[model samples]
Target: MRYACRPVGLLSRSDPISRFDVADVQRFYPRGRPPQPATFDWSFTMNLLGVLPYWQLGPWELGPLTLHSFGLSVAIGVALALSILGSRGQKILGVSGDRMQNFGMWLLIFGWCFSHVFEVVAYQPHIILEDPLVLFKVWGSISSVGGLIGGVIAFLIWRVRNPYEDHIGWSNVAAFTLPIAFFFGRIGCALVHDHPGADATNFVVWEWIRSIFGDSLPEVWPLALQYPDGVPRHDLGFYEAIIFFFLTLFVLYKGRKPQRRGYYLWTLPLLYAPFRFLFDFLRVTPGEAGLHGDTRYLMLTPAQWVAIGMFILGLFLWSKLRNEPLETWKGLEKSTSDDEEPESSSE
Candidate 1:
């Protein structure tokens, strides 16, 4: 696309900038400015076969199978809740103890707010008229992008409050376990077919999918494919699962290494953002505009915009703290210093 600069005033006037076209800049831009990738026909296969176990859980039927999802949900809720409270209690014992407590607390508050805000933004009309309790019960509706934002916010809060606790190190270990939670959540999404993948279009993509699943794609019911009202579903879950699979393996490989204070948590958003941005293309959105690229140079879907903003913010904070080395011995040193102080007996 040929790029042009417009006067600042012209940009302010909607009509002038509205006429700008990104395609016009294509001819002038150097070939391969954006690298091309080898095309694959695995999308369909991924969609159909990747989600086989999920489909076995009937949507309308409430039975033992449903218990699996409820069980998974309870596991995550309990784990997170315990992490937050458990970590906080540990922090209370000393001036500066394990930073995990503060980190967990930040995650709870920020993650809750961001998730709710995105949910409210995505489905405002339903939320506005519906009781708040009802909204919580609606299982398939919370935004992953919002959860990502919450995690990023949590990282920033940790950095500001306790910059010295760097020894907990890169969040790779925490990140490794996170995908299992995601895997379970995805299983839930697939079981409910709660969030449908994108509509199949490419024959290669479809054919590759059909070979593995054997006609299951055409037979899957609409209830499995449909999204909640006011939102469009995407076929990106399979892709997400694939990425997380590799990520989990990477984390396992590095599991023996100790992470710095903030590294384990912050890595989640950094690794997750690009996929979220790219996956936005496969799904339908209300009114997404691409004045430059879909990465929101101009207009973007709510989720996309949130992803971009969070990605930038997360990157900035990561960069700021990237150099700080975690000091494992500091806690012991501080304790020793405390013990050396003169003791006074109270009358």
Candidate 2:
């Protein structure tokens, strides 16, 4: 692929370089409105001869691990997420109390555990037995559902321990943050095109992305790229990123001022669970189809069924919480105080 720069009007101006163009060349405004500048196609050309310029710094002993840019990018994203969370300080559901902070910290730890454990149990069981380095090897294969389960488990356990406390879970906030992580992760995925999925139609947005990246290459490079076949078009990640972005914005909108107990919490499950259940169809899972048509022991994938339960559970909780006295929840008072300006206006 050959890289080309689009010509801006200033760059494309017909005037030749002169001594007058050097210093104090300001205040030259055109009297009339000019035509809108047209966009140019910036692309690069590549062939076998052109693909030799890019070189891998790592050893070729590992088949798929030849110094991939995707891994490095994801590591940076993870670091960014950690930094953001740290800067924000520990808080639970907008209430920055000690109990809430403790709950949030525990929720994150167990959630990480759940996500990884589920990935290992559901898909790659053999890795446990065969690879001594399995712990390190299995970082990327985690299931999102597993993480959710883990986080929920942490929440429930914490809820039990602190039965009197009425506060929203930080997992909801994490759920909001999770997508930002995924957005960055998808970018990494797009950079490497390494996630598992077949090439889609020519008209996909990612197809355009691939083309643009393909064009940025030097004439000769040896970077791992999407072939004509097996071009990883992770549309699921794309959609998930959108969901997370909006959810994050909504959380900021709704939870920034705080609310009564379980308001934002229920909103998350209501929005996420059912949608996730439906979207799971787009995901490629191990043994999705079985001997007897589609496996329906639990009626759907284990994760899908969990999503269904979550949806129903959310509905039930939202109905119950809606009628509860607002004073019972600690965050409602905080919301009232913190958002005193918004509360003063008519509802």
lDDT values, one for every candidate: 0.49, 0.52
Best by lDDT: 2
Per-residue lDDT tens digits for candidate 2, residues 141-172, read 66667777887788788777777644344444
Per-residue lDDT of candidate 1, residues 1-347 (tens digit)? 22232322222222331334334224434455631222334345435533233234433445654445534553664375445334323332233324454455466457656676666656453555756664455343466666656665676766677677532342322344565556545545554443344443342444675667566454332222333432333435545666666665665565444344455455666777777776665554333321111122254556667677767866976886577565243334556667766443321
TM-score of 2: 0.53
Candidates in order, TM-scores: namely: 0.51, 0.53
- Model 1 quality (TM-score): 0.51
Worst 10 residues of 1 by lDDT: 288-297
- For each of the candidates, give the backbone clash count: 26, 15
Position 235, candidate 2: lDDT: 44
